[model samples]
Target: MIDALYVAETGLQAGQKHIDTISNNMANLNTTAYKKGRIEFRDLVVGREVTSLDETGKRDLVSIGNGTQISRVWKEFQSGDLKATENPLDLAIRGGGFFEVLLENGEVAYTRNGAMKVDEDGYLGTLTGYRFSDMIQIPPDAKELEISQDGTVTAYFDNDSLEIGQIQLAGFMNAQGLDSIGQGIYVANDESGNAIYSDAGENGIGILQQGYLESSNVDLVKELVELVTAQRGYQACSHVIRAADEIMQITNDLRG
Candidate 1:
């Protein structure tokens, strides 16, 4: 009966976690460079003893019972598709790489968002006006803008003046080690290792597409399927707990 109660509790908790992930993905369906998350469950029914004593003096061996635990939430790094919107400032990656942007705090951060806009200072930046690491300044009289697959930024001015800039993309050894800073920005950590330099469209890094934006990688159909499975698992666990309770009640009535 006790085991049944613990199982039911863990199952309900896991179901709640799944719901949280689903809601988060749905909320970010329209967010650029958004990655979906998945829940992992680990069965930890045994616990090891932390302390040891003299074998003859005392028995320190202990195995405390534990139930299901949320192992970890994993993020999918699959690249999102690029959709052209005719916006010259828009950028998208065709592979697995991130754009380096300068946050308001003057720190260099990474992002996958390509729906960028220039600020009043003529600085090419995100919609939030945060500057990009490699500023691709457009001439005041520029009329045409183009970005090559190799991260080359070209601007054609009215007077035949052209300016070119190259934006470098960065990747990490362990992408999961990067911490999300909201708005699709990420800060690298020890687990993430250092950013590996790579030319766009070369190697495994993704190519850059000008006038395009990357959509969120979340798949609604996949999330729905997981939601249903979680719900059913919760129901099954509840049934087990209910049956155990019924048996316990009958035993008690017979004893009375």
Candidate 2:
């Protein structure tokens, strides 16, 4: 009964984590370029002491799986739906690549959010104000801005156009290993490897689509179904714990 109680407690914990991940995904369904999170679980095993002696007086070690635990929470890198905003500054990636941005602390971060804004200094940046690290600046008095599929930036003024700067996309050996730093920014970790710079449409990188933005990849129906499963699993674990407690109570009553 004690072991059952402990196992049920672990189950409850795992179920709670699962539900939390699902809730986060659902909440970010409308977030621009938002990637969904997933929780992985592993079984916890308990083993007998190696020095323990069996009935035959010989040392024996036995292993038994006790319960489950959350192994990891990973992000899904699948592309989201591309939405047409008709805004000239809006951009969408048609393949795999992340936009490079410079953080306040001068650290580099990556994102898939392409909703951009031009600052007073003619600096191009994300809607949240993270400027492009590559110094892609727009010129003042430019009547129009154009971003080519290859990420070349062109400014048009008085029926004349000039190439200013180019936006470079960064690719990773393992994009899933990137750490989410909130606000659609991700920093590369050891597991994610180093960021590989490439032209937007070159070297397996994705092309940029002007006047579009990428939508969150979260699937509402799938998340709702998973939410139901997590809730049921939690309830079942609770029932197990209650049953174990009742068994102990019954034993005490019988002794009395």
Q: How high is the lDDT of residue 124 in model 2?
A: 93
Estimate the lDDT of model 2: 0.94
The TM-scores of all predictions, comma-separated, are 0.85, 0.95
Quote the lDDT for 107 in model 2: 91
Pairs that collide, model 2: none
Global lDDT for candidate 1? 0.82
Candidate 2's residue-wise lDDT over 54-158, tens digit each? Answer: 899988877887989999899999999899999999999999999999999999999999999997787999988899997877877899999999999999999
Q: What is the lDDT of residue 154 in candidate 1?
A: 78
List the lowest-lDDT window of 10 residues for candidate 1: 58-67
